[model samples]
Every structure is written in C-alpha cells, then in structure tokens.
Target: MSILREARLSDLPAIETLVKAAYGHYVDRIGTIPGPMRDIDDHRYARHIEAGHVSLLFDNADGEESVDAGNGDKPVGLLVLIPQTDTLLLDNVAVAPSAQGRGFGKALMQAAEARARQLEFDSITLYTQELMHENLAIYRRYGYVETHRAEEFGLKRVYLRKSLA
Candidate 1:
C-alpha cells in the first residue's frame, strides 16, 4: 500500500530528486524542459508546503518503517493540488522513474480525486503538453475529458477536466 500525506519542509530534497528523475527524460522529447522540471524548485515546494498544496505519496511495499526513520519510507510519488472555488487543479503529478510501473501514478490520481472530494470540489482540472501522448491517454483512462486546446508559454497545451458530481 501507499500512504498520502501533506509534504513537510524536510521532504523538499527528496521531492526535488523525484521530480527531476521523473521529468528529466521528457526534456529531449519536448524540445524543452517540461513545465514541471522548470518549476520544481525548493522555494516553490516550500511555498506549496506552507500553503498545504503539496502531498507526498509513500510506498510501503518495501516494508518501510516510517518517513521520519532516515529515508525508510522515501516518497515514490508527489502531487501538487491547488483547490479552487469549485475545482481542484492537479498542477503536477510525478512518480519517480524507479517507481514508475508499480501503479504509483494511478494511485496518486485516485488520491487526487479523494482529495478533491474531501475539499468539497465538484470537479478537477489539469493540463498536459499536447505532445505528451502517454499522459493524455492516462488522463483519459481516468475519465478526464479534453476541454480545450491552447498555446501557453509557447507550448501547445491540452486542458482536461473530470466532473465529480
């Protein structure tokens, strides 16, 4: 099983490492550093943690003891959830490359849905680069529908939304 909890300041380093490992490969495919790669900085994480917008998903399958036990339960995935008036924006979801095929990404999406419900959101929204076919497929498989397409910051972005109610 995996545990999801708010990220603490101490987890910043590990979170940064995970984000880099997860998004570094996309730099070549997209011809530029992905948004997540450019945005995953310690200051940004600190701000998000302070605002209660970041969550770390820990994999316990390895029988890890605790997050505070000196890297025992290192995070396998991270999420940046921003709650809006009627929706939760899934700004970022990154699963460490080493942990990729273990269902962590799907687990994190499920967690994000739960979070949206808990926060009383009626829907959730996210956007991905138009070139990221795999991501688009995964979001679609999770029931997200494309709402529109636009060029943002010079990247063609496909916005998607899933209604919860």
Candidate 2:
C-alpha cells in the first residue's frame, strides 16, 4: 500500500534528494539544472513545508511490499500544492525515476486534485518546462488543458489547468 502525508521540516533533505534524483536527468535534455533543484538549494521547500503545501508519497507502508524497490521508508514521490484565490496551484509533482511506472506519480496527481476539492477550488493550475514533453503528455492524459506557453523563471514553460467544477 502507498501512503501520502504532508511533509514536515525533517523531510526537507529527503525531498531534496528525491527531487534531484527525479528531475536530474533533465539537465542534459534541457541544458541546466531544473528549477526544482535550484529551488531546493535556495531553501524554497523549507518555506513550502512550513506552510503545509508539500505532500510526500511513500510505498511499502506495511513493511511487506516496498514500492521503492524495498526502500519502502524513502518517499517515492512528492507533490507541492498551494491554494490560490480561485484555483489550487500544483506547484510541482515529482516521482523518483527509479519508481516510475508503479503508479506513484498518478497517486500524487490524484492527491493534488483531492486537495483542490478540499480547499473548495474549482480548478488546479500547473506548469512544466516546455522541453519536458513527457510531463506534458502525462498532464494532458490527466485532463489538464493547455492554457498558454511563455517564458517564466528563466524557463520556457507550458501552463495548464484542470477544472473540477
């Protein structure tokens, strides 16, 4: 079974490591450290975690089945969700590359949507680097429609939104 919970201050280091391992390969594909890694180093996640906007997904809660290939205690995926005036923003959703294809990413997406409803938001918004076609396909498959494309934060980004109501 997989477990999802809010991230605590103590989880910062693990989240940083997991995020780097998850998005690190993009450096070659996009030519530069991904935004998340840079943000990690800047202690951005520290503020997010403190604000309760981060959630971690862990596999193998039962100690019998390890979703992270036996490293059950380690988080396999994470989601950073922040509430906006009328939309819930999906700041980031990352799954350990090694843990891909095991549904952890899907679980985190579901969590984001669930949180949107909990916050009484009718829509969720997110963005990804334009070169991350893999993420674009996944987000489209999950019903996020492209809202626009623009350069933001030094990265060409594709913005998307999903409406729940």
Measured by TM-score, how close is model 1 to the native structure?
0.92
Model 2, 1-165: lDDT tens digits are: 887878888788789889899999899998878888888878999999999999888886576542331332688899999898989999989998889998888889998999899889999999999999999999999999999999867788899999999
Clashes of 1: 0
Considering every candidate listed, which one attains the maximal lDDT?
Answer: 2
Model 2 local distance difference test score: 0.88
Cα lDDT for residue 69, model 2? 19
User: Candidate 2: which stretches are off by over 4 Å?
Assistant: 61-72
Model 1 lDDT at residue 115: 90
What are the clashing pairs of model 1?
none
**Which residue pairs in candidate 2 collide?**
none
Error of 1 at 114 (Å): 0.6
